[model samples]
Target: MKVQLLVSKWCPVCPQAERIWTEAAQKVPMDLEVLDVAERNGREVVSRLRIKTVPAVVVDGTLKTVGVQPLGEVLKLLGA
Candidate 1:
């Protein structure tokens, strides 16, 4: 599975989101990419998905959820 995490450096909760997903990725067999909203790739995703919040999770090109999800929830999302 392809997992894309949309985040920003200034977002306080983004780091937490990153940590959860990063740890999940290490345990699961999936592709994980962290994208900054200010970057071109992240902007494309935000525009396409109409995402209005930071710490968004895109699983296989589909917007799964937003905000800092719990580690268990993130693992579940990854189907781990």
Candidate 2:
């Protein structure tokens, strides 16, 4: 599964989300992709993914997480 984390530069929520995804990544068979919204292809990814919030987590091309989340919380979302 492809797990993409879309976050903004200096976003308060990004760090927490990152930790959760990082932990979940270890437990799940997923390719993790972290994208900073301020970088190249950032806008396009958000647009194609229909992301309206930061710290967004997309799994298998579907938006599954938004905003900040705890590691345990994220795991439940990923069914890990």
Candidate 3:
């Protein structure tokens, strides 16, 4: 599975999301990608995904969840 953790440089919750997903990635077998919403590619992705918030998770090209999700929820989303 492929997981994209979308974050914004100024968002307070972004770090939390990153940390949570980073830890989860160690236990899961999926590929994880971290995107900064402030950048061009990240902006394009956010726009394409129709995401209005930071700390979003995209699973296999589909936006799955938004906000800072717990590690368990993230792992569950990845079917780990």
In order, candidate lDDTs are 0.92, 0.83, 0.88
The TM-score that candidate 2 achieves is 0.87
Q: Tens digit of lDDT per residue, candidate 2, span 20-80?
A: 7888899877899998888876677898987888988888888886888877887787777
Off by over 4 Å in 1: none
What is candidate 3's local distance difference test score? 0.88
Q: Compute each candidate's TM-score over C-alphas.
A: 0.95, 0.87, 0.93
lDDT of candidate 1?
0.92
Clashes of each: 0, 0, 0
lDDT of 3 by residue, 15-53 (tens): 989999999989988789999989887898899989999
Q: Positional deviation of 2 in candidate 3, in angstroms?
A: 1.3
lDDT of 1 by residue, 1-80 (tens): 99999999999999989998889988898899999999999999999999999999998989999999888988887777
Instruction: Give per-residue lDDT, candidate 1, residue 29.
Output: 86
